[model samples]
Target: MAATIIDVARRAGLSTATVSRALRGLPNVSESARARVQQAAEELSYTVSPIASQLSSGRTGAVGVVLPFVNRWFFGQVVSGIDSVLRANDMDLLLYNLGDTRVHERFFERMPVRRRVDALIVLTLPLSEDETRALSSLAVPVAVLGEPTPPFWNVRIDNSVAAATAVRHLVNLGHRRIGLITGAAHDPRRFATPILRRDAYRTALEAAGIRYDPRLEAMGHFGIEEGAAAMAQLLTLPEPPTAVFAESDEMAFGALRTLRRMRLRCPEDVSVIGFDDHETAHLMDLTTIAQPVVEQGALLARLVLKALAGSHEEPSDTVLPTRLVVRGTTGVARRDAAPGVPPSPGAATDNGTGARGARSPVP
Candidate 1:
C-alpha cells in the first residue's frame, strides 16, 4: 500500500499524532523522535497522500482575514496589499467583518474559524483583554496587521509619533490656531485614535507655545461624511481655524469636500492635512503622512506564511516609520503678512499609537 500516516507511525514506534506532527515539522516532537520518524518514512518509501492528508487535517487550505470596516480608505488599501501577497503565495483568503460589537462578538466568540483556516491576520480593532485571551488559545497560528499583538506575530507603526510629525509639519508652518478634527474615536475613554492623535496634537501645540482649545476640536466617525460634518461645524465659529490636521485621508477628503462646497480654497482659506497617503490623497493633492501600508501588508502576510510552514519561532513585533508628503492641500497658515487676518494660539499634551491591522477580515 502507498505510504500512510498510520504506516509511518507504526514503523517509527510513535503514536500517529506524533508522526503527523513530525511530518509537519511542528516543534513539540523531540529531535530524536523526528529523526526516527523521518528514517522510518524513507524506509517505507512513504509519500504523503494529498487527499488523505486533507481528510485527516483540519485546515481548509485558507487564510482568515479579520478587519473592521472595509469601506474606509486605509482599510481598503491595506486589504488590496494583503490580497496581492496571498494571491502570489497560492493561498485563498476568507473574509470576516467586525464593524460593530455584535458582528465582532458573534464570530470571534463562536470561533467558527477554528480549523477552517490555517492562519489568521487581524487588521485593527484592539482586542480587549478577554478577546486577546481567547485569541491566544486558538488552535491555528495568528498574525496581526495593525496593532502589536502579544504571543503572536505582528507589524505596526507609532501612532503618537505619526500624529506628532503631522502636527509638527503645521507647527513648522507657523500655524498657531491649528485645529484638529478627529472623530468619536478621539475620546479615548470611549474610542481609540482620537485620544492618541489628540495627545500628539497637544504635544506639538505646547511645544509651539499654543494653548489647547477644546472649542477648536470636533469629533466624527471614520468616514468622509464625518469629515464634512466636522468641517461645517468648525466653519461658523467666530474664530475659524487657520489650519486643520485630520487623522485620516477619508476625513481630510471630507474636509476638502466641505471646503469646496463652501467655495473656500485649501492652504489659502485654511490649510488641510490628513493621515494615510491613500491613492485618493494623491488624486486630491492632500498633504499628509505617508504610512508604508502596502509594505506592512507584505510583512504581515509573510509572518502568516511562516506560521503555516511550521517555522514560527518566538513572537515578533515590528514597527514601521512614516514620512511627510507635501501636496496642495496644506500651506502656510493664513496669518501671513497679508492685509486681513488675526493671530492665533495653541494647546499642549503628550501621547501614543499602533499599526499592524490587515486586510481580509480585520478592521
Candidate 2:
C-alpha cells in the first residue's frame, strides 16, 4: 500500500499536523522537523492523495479558469502561462469557455462552482458588477485576468497604452493621415476591450493636435474577415489614409492581405502597425506593440493560489506596460499625386515626433 501522511508522521516521530506543515513547506515547521519529515516520507514511500488532502484540508487542489474566448491567440497564450505555474503547484486546471452569452448566463445562474474547485480565474469574462457579485457569492477565491471585471484579484495589461503605442508608431513614421480599426462599439457589453483601445487612440491623436476624423476610424469584428474589410473600406476613401493602426495583429494580417489584393505596396503607399506582437506579426514583418501575455497568466495563477489560501481579499487591477517594436511596415509618407494634383512637397520626414500635422498635405 502507498504510504500515507500518518505513516510518514509516525516514522518521523512527529504529530500529523507537523508532518503536514513540513510537507507543505509552511514557515512554522522547524528545519529539523522538515528534514526528518522528508526523510521519513522517502523511507516509507509516501505520496500525498490530492483528493484526500482536499477533503480533509478543505481545498479542492483544482482551479477553474473561465475565459470568454479561448480560440483567440491572446487568451490561449495567457491560459498556457497560467497552466505552467498551476501544474508546478500540483493543481489541476478546469477550463470553461464562456464565449456565448446564453451559455455563460446559464452557468453563472446555476452557480455550479460550489465545492467543485478551490478558486476561480476569469479571463476577459465580459462580466458586469452584478454578475461578478453573483460569482463571488460562491464563497471561494476568484482571480480575473485581462480587462478588469473588478472586485476580484486582477492581472491585466493597459489597453490604453497599447493603443497609444500603435498610433504613436504610425504618427512618428511621418504618416499624418492615420486610420484606426478596432472591435465594434455597437455592442457595449460584448467588446469592452476594443472600446478602451479606441479611447486611447483618440487621446493620443488629440495630444498630437490631430483632429479625430470619424472617416479614419471604423468598427471591426475581432477576426480576419473584418480586418480585411476595414482596410478595404479605409483604402476606398477619396482622401485615403496614409497609415493604418489595427488593434490586433490578426486584424493587421487581414489588412495586409487587403493591401496585397489592391496592389498597394507597404511603406510605399501606406504604413501599418498592430498590437500583440503575435508570431505571425514577425513572419509578416509587421511593426507592433509587444506585451507579456503569458506573464499575465502566471500572475493570475499566483493570485488564484492566494485566493484559495484565503490570503487574497483586496481586489486589484494591475496594468502591465508595453513597448514599441519597429518593423518593415511603416515609413515616411509617399507622394502619390492624383491627376492635375499640385505637388510642392518632398518626402515628409518624421523626426521621431508623432503626429506633427493632421488633416494637412504631407510635408
State residue 301's C-alpha deviation in candidate 2, in Å: 0.5
User: In candidate 2, where is summed lDDT lowest over 10 consecutive residues?
Assistant: 339-348
Sliding window of 10 residues with minimal summed lDDT for model 1: 344-353
Evaluate residue 287 in candidate 2 and report its C-alpha lDDT on the 0 to 100 scale.
85
> lDDT per residue, candidate 1, 1-363, as tens digits?
687778889989999989988887778999999999999999999876654565567556678888877776667777777788888987778888777767887876797777777888888777778887777777677888756768778888888899999988887877777887885563332444566777899888888898888877877576799889998888767777878889888888888888777766666667889988977688888899889988887787888888778884887989999889998877665433332232222211111123321211100
Candidate 2 matches the true fold with a TM-score of 0.78
* Model 1: residues with Cα > 4 Å off, grouped in runs: 1-53, 186-191, 336-363
Best by lDDT: 2
Can you write out model 2's per-residue Cα lDDT over 36-59, one digit (the tens) per residue? 999999899887666766786777
